[model samples]
Target: MAPTSTAEPRPSTTAYRQARDTLVALTGQHDRAVAEFRWPEVGERFSWAIDWFDQIARGNATTALWIVEEDGSELKLSFDELATRSDQVAVWLSGLGVAKGDRVLLMLGNQVELWETMLGVFKLGAVIMPTTAALGPADLRDRVERGGARVVVANAADSAKFDEVPGDYLRVCVGEADGWHAYADAYAEQPHPFETVTASTDPLLLYFTSGTTSKPKLVEHTQVSYPVGHLSTMYWIGARPGDVHLAISSPGWAKHAWSCFFAPWIAEATIFVYNYTRFDAGRLLDQIRRAGVTTFCAPPTVWRMLIQADLSGGKGDLRELLAAGEPLNPEVITQVQHAWDLTIRDGYGQTETTLQIGNIAGEPLKPGSMGRPMPGVPVALLDPLTGELADEGEIVLDLSRHPVNLMTGYLGDEERQAEAMAGGYYHTGDVAQRDSDGYITYIGRTDDVFKASDYKVSPFELESVLIEHPAVAEAAVVPAPDPTRLAVPKAYIALAPGWEPDAETAKAILAHARGHLAPYLRVRRIEFFELPKTISGKIRRVELRDREQRAFDGGQSLSQEFRDDQFPDLKA
Candidate 1:
């Protein structure tokens, strides 16, 4: 069976046979799969959990989902066992007033309860609002009220987080709890598979957009966009059925669903995870080697940290490698390639979309460039001023072409949605420079771009160059206050292992930056500080920008080095 669509017919490489033939090719390794593939034109009443998983789970009583640990502990669930458990859970949840369209907030870690709740919610046709365990009381209040969540499924240990959140919503806690409803009791009920009472366009998931500058906006996705659009993601990862794919991402983020759920399941792959109280690169590599992980995906932060560890110090049968969440520094890419002999392929996407751009397997690799748009994706770079597309500008999707993977709209923000979808293009608010060779290198965010001395500066470009320096581990570039040039590029760096904060070290990094960057684009100021990151490991540049503004407002002393002021005898 192929992915089906009920909307206006559109033209693309995706058709009914695209998905079916791709599946057949992946399973059979036939050359004709590409030529015979089709993306099913699904009807308006589509439920992928019911359509795909149930059909595939029939008669497959063997292991379906596996959770392994570093201590040799593992939890394995059979296809039949999970199906029956989910059926009983759906009945029990529905009886507790969780009906179709009612939002259910889920806050858990990398445990089996997360998957069980996901299946039960999809079976009951309820909207899932995945929340990270890192969220505190205030964030929980926002999620409960503004998120329209009528029920919450969380771990018993974290149940106290909702104590300050005033609501009449139903509380279902996994594991032992004192005053909360015990979720394990649902198994006492009769097993019954659920019937879908809603269509494919129904609201199935609501994600809280990590508002870096403002309040978090609620992004809504229909039942189909994530379930079906992830086909592009599965293809990008080159994940095959039974492949043990491990993606280093936490819950509540879009990347989690991309590799952890929709994409892996669509490819019939086994989702692997290693619970860690602290991040140990060597330990993680050991788990991968011991588990025989086939497909591995992680963010740039993890990739950078991994390179600091000994590559040959560990052994793993890692076949496919992927990096996302943010633009990767070329130096990190070079180090990994030099050590592992495997290029860390770059990909581009946002919370609003799926794997729209990526460096797929069997495709050419480009340095510091995210590969061309994946299958079923149409990407165009438009000039911000002229509103006309060019080879390099802001990335936008031609919505008139009707990509099924597109989101429904931002909840309660019609004007924002209109602005986003204006002029028949959905602006991504991020800039990328595209080459004639079809490779796109990610620039800074639209707001992150600042002008210095009448010359536009991309923070990412300077930051990437800063990270190339031996003393720098992570860096973020921003414009600093300058009375003469109006503004100058400044860098906040996290030193590499065994590196220290000293005048000698800072001067060397600044000299290296001056050689790589243009005269006006050089890093005039440098500060040795830790990079602020979100729970998803993405650098919080907004925090750095705020600190820069504060320093500009008040005279403050920070470690900064400039050219022509000192240090004249360097290679540059």
Candidate 2:
């Protein structure tokens, strides 16, 4: 894309490749890799598409992408083909006046055009603002306005959602739509040499954080922050060249880019995708086997569902398994291991950064622990009160070490940036505990942790215990007001299939929790209610906390709630 430079590989590009290869070589030696790895010095001007992708793609027939549809149709593209196709797409977009630094709102599902357009936009040095198709007019309007989107590329069916969204940005659709430029027209353009316009520090992506606590913040990532920084992610995933890496993630989210796009590509692995309207564990397992997937990653939700379904058939070709999104419950991990003889290594990161910490492949994994700090990530835990490094505290990256994986900061919000980077560290807001062996385990968010009866309570710890019960499918724990103790733990639970929301079920669940958890961490109240979640499927504990506080202030109790006192047999 960058004029097909006749010259040799740039110093920066060579450094990047060497760094990636080193990680690939050090896959099984986790400690040695972390101790020895260093971030490559990518100089001022750099374009990942032109420098990294295109260079590796030339004359290479290796599969770069593989997508399997729900209806059994499949598509495969070689690295060379994708490179040339993206070049033509870049030419066509340039023809439509889409230039460098123009912000484009990308709202498409798991389609080939999405990948093509992404690469093309990267080639042109434009910023991508990926939005989920599930968003309605209100969210779309907010993203378009806040992201300062100047162009839109979406599925034809999604074009009408923009009718109520007032904007003068250019519209392009993958399918036939009136007043929208046809995305298929890109194939009509001939591949041509293009000049690179991106700098290492230029904003390449604007991601809207899934708002679990408050309004979603617009996180801006520079070219090097993701494209180059995901070296850590690639290492964590244990992906290698020629491997087919499949990750369960929806479009428009940061994890989608982390696993589905950047990390796998960095490893020179084929990115495998399976699209299904509804999740069927049996069918998903069949696809994994059929595709010969070597590396796989999914959120904890998927892992839970898979464990509930039968896994006795066997793990097909999966060598490395990973879980992220939220902390993976130990029960889910244990069940999977019992069935497949493979452990699901949990990872930790945010929309603002790549994989900062993870249970690296072939390393000794501690159940319920997210693992050590990833290579090249300056991870530390700072005590909230003392503002110093501690064994258990808020997770932060030492800015003094210069963390390249982190975002530039919240876009257009200097105040928030200043607060986040205060005390010479980039605050992660999430709390965690580090063992003497250097393994860091996630606790909960700073806002989600609360004091009950003078003891600190982590909602994740309680929820993890609750889900271990047979009747509980999903659970969210929040602090409810108490008469004597300042607060008490209250669980909002979703019942498993065939489980009734009745006194007997609640009593059994509470008894199970009492047996597993410490007395100070007892769940005092529980309500059989569906858990609220963000569009990304993360449980919204903030909303549950608010609901509990409101009910307490009004001196009213939810009729669906069952208190420990009501279950007299629990005292036995």
Candidate 3:
């Protein structure tokens, strides 16, 4: 028997597929792809779930999603099965008063129910607010208040976090919980017809930025912005049909939607997940080998941890490797290339947009460079002071081209939006430099770049060098108050296993930095400390900077902080 869609195929679906296949055909031809690729002109009405996912899922028996748990329990859903299942879920949610354009706060782990609910919400035309379960009651309250959430779907175990959250929103839980509707009840009924009617510019997703520097901003995405914009991301990953793609990301953030949801599905590839309570590199490798994963994307932190583990066994069935979330250090790339016989391609993007730049597969890569602008992404580096194009400055997207991948704007914050989209460009707070060959190398964030004795300093440049040392596992560099130089680079080091955080380790790390870095970029002082991070695992350098400022103002010296003068050998 042939499976059928709940609704008929729309023209928008064919347009999107044609655009996607065009880019796929030019997979290895980076130059031609960039020059010829154009954004699909999706007309007014477009619903990716009903138009694209459903049309492809009809009568398709291929596995679309694969999830493996730590306890060895697994779940696999075929394309046809997922389409029918999501249709039933949409009907059930509609029965529960979930209406079009209503805001639904979805907080779930990397489970099958999460995917089902997301697709169902998309079909129902409801705006999804992806909140991390790690959020506490305080943060939840703020989201509810500011986001104007009308419904909330959460795990039963996390329901307590919302007990203090005052909202009139309907509560639905995956497991049994008092005062909450059972999510399992959605499966009790057969599928029903649910039409998806939404404009291409209709709001589909609302993501809160990980508040690394300040309060989290509400980023709004249209129906096509993510579902269609991720074509570039799919191209960067080189995902092909039937390929099992695994991306290490949580459900709450945009990266999750970037890899686990849109990009893989857009390519008609299997979205594979290996959920573990704790990160175990060996077990992850086992799953990758067992499932025969072809494409993989992970953050720089995970890559660093994986290198520490045994990689004597070669990479299994892996064709593409990628790292993002931050600029990857060159040494880590070298180590992985030596062991796995594969180079981890580096890419760059932000929560507000899809992949803007990346090392395309099958193209020659420049070491430490994040490749040229992605096809259809209007990338340009503009001078921060002059607001004109520069070889090295803040990275901005040319708004004149009407890039479809960018978010509509910051929701309800016109002043910030005006500033962000000022000068006919979208300012990405980070800065970068482009070589004559057009390969872009990431500098530090605009706020993170400082100066010492009138010479500019980039924290990432120093931290990259510090991590190359044997004793240093992770390092965060900030400006320390100095008497003569006004300010100097001070490093907070986290020692690796079998290394002690003593004076000897600090001196070794300092000397290594001096030898590798230029004189102006030398590490002046070091302290053994744990780095602070946001919930998303990004280093909270703002806190570190504040700590340094306070310590300098108090005229106090840390007992463990080592200065270059303390080690006469470093004085050279």
Candidate 4:
């Protein structure tokens, strides 16, 4: 089938190219250029719609976005068509009392409706609180209430979740459903081009972080925070003009919005998404080949699974590959680089901010490092003891410099913001180790660190080592119940191919850990079990730590594979 047609306007060649190049050079090692980097200053008479989107949509008529299916079903929307469609949706939503600055919840899957609604909401200057289609009632309720959402655009299948969530917000559903606004109806309405009534500093985006240990916190971003902040993200992901880029991430998370909306658009790259019910490596590879995807990014969990598939399959039209969301293990990175002849550049950031550290296009990628700080992000490693810059400590952002990328502060919690932004810096609460070359390698969460004797241990360091072991399919390291050493580093391991949960397997892994680790960091206990992960596929160490706390609840209930006393020969 032919692609969609349009008569949309395009940005000035100079401005668009300037935006593109600025993003690419943000990660370069230039002190003067980076220090001078500031948020693109705009007036209160600001509107990304008229200033940015309309300019870009001025003369573009080709397919600006495409979503192709495995069975050859495809959907292409041109820049002009998208602009017109979004204008109509903006008009329709305005008629429904969806006013500028009003918070609206966007909860949809990879359907075309998501794009239409996102643009429509932006055009109307409505602050978007994006939710995932996978969200349950509990998650949705917190979003609507805490976010003060006035309207919600969600998939029809997820409409049932709203039943349990009490809210006075307007409910609009895509796909087939009764008593809901038909999103396609907007096409019948005339496109009423709009200019935002709000300022650039006003709230435009709000994200809820995954609360692994506590309840989720609401993170607020301004109109400029994401729109301009993603310049670094675009640079980090190595997106380019006319490049078909794919970033595999769920909707609710910040990573999705980072690449799906701002980063690719900032680069003028055609955002390509392969929508499937579940992740399939072969299917994804086929999709990548079919779409000619140049820049590909996915979480480490997806990369881990992708490597497990037959890497000997078709080498798709891939130019750049990247991994984030979790620390990419060196073994996983090495496997893909060797197989596909493509390096998986690791990146680091949080829901509260944009890309802070990443191996950008121009940099030499040191495996297992998340690269140096991006331009405009004044990053420092703060010592935990005195909160001073250190060689190895928490990754903190210096707020003294005027940077606009950070969240406006956690919603309704000035005290929390004060604490996080204390010590003249913004604490990330994630630990890292910087080498002499300034490459930052992720250690683990500050809370996840434990003590084995007097030595400090990073759970990620131990888990990374365990996952490299042939017998370990997956692993989670946390403090184990111990009598003498206070707490010992214990690993819950998942067996790889041909490995079984038996005395022989346990003995081999224990022996392997002993051989690799220092005396203070040895895996004192090993449990052969599948690891539990969060919705985003991060290992839920909080849950594991709780389990260890209860292990000593009854009589000393150590893990079945645990053997602290069995390895006497190595200790001797």
Candidate 5:
């Protein structure tokens, strides 16, 4: 279907369309795409939800969204239906005094209303602060106070969390609830066409990033930063028109918007979602098969769990598979390829930017590498000391070109923003090594890397090797204090099913790590415990490091910890 000729706002629709078409044409050609792709120079009055989405949505009958519940209930909406429904929602919200640039705290799950509210908020030019439903009253209070939210939209079950949260913000509920505006009332309103009240540079999203070491930082993204910048992500995921893209991510994180919203919509693809209360790999795979998912993107955690389940049941219509949010272990990738004959590609990006690096489809597979710099993303490995380009160093974005994908800055924190955008480069705070082929292999976070016996040790590398053990399910490597060496590599592991935290299991895991890693990178200590993580499911290595430091300082010992030095018979 072709887009209708609607009078576009300030940005000439021609420029945006041409740039988008160029990317679509260069889907499989990685090198050319990287060289020729450019961020479109949008005019000052551009609005993506108004100019782009509504344009493509006119007269389009293709399925735009498909959501399946745990109980087998489903909700499907076509492009035209969503466009019209979002228009009504925008009108209803406008009537409730929502104006352009007003901050709205949106906290909801994977329901149809969430998507509708997002689009409506976008259409109204309101800044959306996407919050996870998992947060408690304390977190909500922090968000409302710091974000200056004028309105809050959440599910009925979560509405009571705001009882003690002092705010004058409008309380809008998804389901029926007292003292809250019902969201379903918008559906009964007459359909109204959306008009633009935003510029291309206006703030569209205020994301509270899940901080690993400190308090969560508020990352701000402009109108063009995410919606238009996700072309790189769309290309990386190989989201072609009519393809059903399924990305398993929570509602609050940037990854959700990366795949579930912008990337899929940019490709004119169907956003497929399966909502489950628990982690059931079998049921997820069954839903994928039933939905005929073609392009799939999931975090490494989900991919790891999926591999543990039966993959012998044949690959569903899944053509492209991707893993992000964290570094994917080579063992997990190898196991999936062996079962389905399809490689699980890896990609790298952050909440502060769109897809910076990714393994594009049809590209040569490099084990343990997160492929090359994404098209139009000026990526460089800068030496932390000299700020010179290096083969292995901190991953930085060359701001000389000022990539459109990057966030505006850390909101209300000018000092941190200046630090992050210093030296004419946007420091990612992560480290990597770029090989001759330009494939960037992840090292570890800058703070997570530690020195042991005068040798630099990357926790991710050790954790990757440790997870290869049969008894290990998930593992985190942190520095454990030592009498001789400053620190030694210690692994905190979560055992797989049927594996006990006994001496026998610990001995086998230690032996496996000894066989796999180099002498200097050997696991000197092992502990059986549940790994701590943020709400977004990322392992909190800083917490482990702190615990180890306190234990060493107080001359205290942790329970269930085994030391390689304790078993002198085992050779490193």
Candidate 6:
């Protein structure tokens, strides 16, 4: 006889659906949306993976995940498919001794198993420690030790890296690997409904910040902080139900959760992905055209590369174009606008918080501005020296409101936590200037901004001008020490295709900077070198600053560097 089976009653999502529908209805109505929206008051025993994802996924046939591989292969998973699969994985993992509060280290690429594990872990109320696949043994060891991870999920190719990482954690490999549990075995298990064991404030994720200046800090987020807080990101990206949103970010980064998972999922939209081993802007555009991606988000690096390709191929039904990871230069935005007739909105946020400010849809965009403070996010610019509110200073969030988007301090670092949460505010450590209309224009980081001839010089401001030159592809500006002025603006440039690293190319870039910038902010020194970047592709300006300091101390000039003074005719 066949095994007897009974259907389980669908989980109630009355409150969750009410809140989600409110935001979905208010799309493109910025003022009304901000004024009427309120963070849902979920009581104890709230698990987004179960309460939200699975509830909405019931009998839903809409594609939730679409992954296109480099070799023209693809994988599509509907909401119901993922829901059932994750349920099976959750039961399988639970049998493997994984339980509530366990820390599971997830280090996988953009694969179906990554999503399944994320959902399964959440179903078990386990804490997720997301690490990039690009990490080596040293980074992995630090994550395991600092994060207190008890289980590790990685691809078969990365299993060998764990040999050097000493831990008693359960090793679960996505594909076949010796002595590791096969992820394929989970699919054979009987699917079961996931029971919720999480509270609203329970720890859900631990992220190691992409260390650009110092060592990476462990950023902790609760079940609500990210899953609920990304409502602002949904608003910023203009996500809507039935829309396809493609956010060009690698897994393990906060932005991935921001758009690739929570934001789009909350909006009941399709999460589209193009998994490429190597970035080909033309190929990416072709996929976008083919997929009918409605909303798109990418870092400045990817946007710059896209403009180099022929953008005329297919617009891909793209309605909203957004840029983050760093401030979007006006020149790049202009190039895209000229090609697509759509403005690329800029947004500002960090690993420490959700979307604090952004150029939302249905708003007039200032070319270089990052738009206004997101609704429900109270922002103030405090003078770095005075610690008083100012129009142009360090950006901070008012702690009085206790915004749900902010992280719950850095884990295991009370000193840093206190410093960041001091003065009744959460200091962002970045500087910006607000106009009378309240739009914020990003300056360099608080540490990146330097003084030259008693005038403050923003490297971003200078680098923006440098990239406007035809010969330059990417540029990093740092203050080079000088005896007379203490420090001067020096540009390290990576040339565009067909441009050489010769003196002529440097001269042309310097001339362009001199023409576009003020006399005090001119690019005095030029060097043709590759900019150092973090594994997540963020430019590490701190590394370049250290190099500048060392060069100044040695009093020996690098042979590769070119100075504006070296070419007399190029100077203003």
Residues 405-461, candidate 2: write the lDDT tens digits.
Answer: 999999878888899999999999999999989999888999999999999999999
TM-score of each candidate structure, all chains considered together: 0.92, 0.98, 0.98, 0.93, 0.98, 0.97
Tell me, what's the RMSD of every candidate? 4.3, 2.3, 1.9, 3.1, 1.6, 3.4
> Which candidate number maximizes lDDT?
2
- Output the worst ten-in-a-row residue range by lDDT, candidate 5: 1-10
Lowest lDDT 10-mer window, candidate 1?
4-13
What is the RMSD of candidate 3? Answer: 1.9
Residue range 1-572, candidate 4, lDDT tens digits:
12222334333333434655765555454444366555555555455555566556645675668987656788998777777788888888888889888998998877677777878888888888888777789878878889998998987887888888887888887875766777777778888667657687888889888876667788998877777777778878887677888989888778888888778877767889887876788889888887899999998778877877888875688988988888888999899878988888888888889989888775687867888888778889999998779989999988897556788889987888898899889988899999998889988898898887878999888877777778877888999767788889988887877877987787777888877778889998888777877666677889889988887666567547658577565432
Candidate 5 achieves a global lDDT of 0.90
Displacement of the residue 171 alpha carbon in candidate 1, Å: 0.2
Off by over 4 Å in 6: 1-12
Model 4 clash pairs? 8-57, 8-58, 9-57, 9-58, 9-59, 10-58, 10-59, 11-56
Q: Is candidate 1 or candidate 2 better by lDDT?
A: 2
Local error of candidate 5 at residue 531 (angstroms) = 0.4
TM-score of 6: 0.97
In terms of lDDT, model 6 sits at 0.88
lDDT of 3 by residue, 1-572 (tens): 22334445577877887888888899889999989998987788888888888888877888899999999999999888888888888888899999889999999999988888998999999999999999999999999988999999999999999899998999999999999999999998689645668888899999999988999999999998899899999999999887899999998999999999999999899999999999999999989999999999999999989989888877999999999998898889989999988989999999999999999989889988999999999999999998889999999999999888999999889998999999999999999999998999998899899999889999999999988887878889999877888899999988888998888888888889998999999999999999999889898899989999998899988888998889886643
lDDT of 6 by residue, 351-465 (tens): 8888999998888889889998887788899998998999999999999988888998899999889999999999999999999998999997889999999999999988888
| Model 1 ranges off by over 4 Å | 1-20, 23-38, 313-315, 555-571
Candidate lDDT scores, in order, read 0.78, 0.91, 0.91, 0.79, 0.90, 0.88
Error in Å for residue 473 of model 6: 0.9
Alpha-carbon shift of residue 376 in model 1 (angstroms)? 1.4
Backbone-clash count (model 4): 8
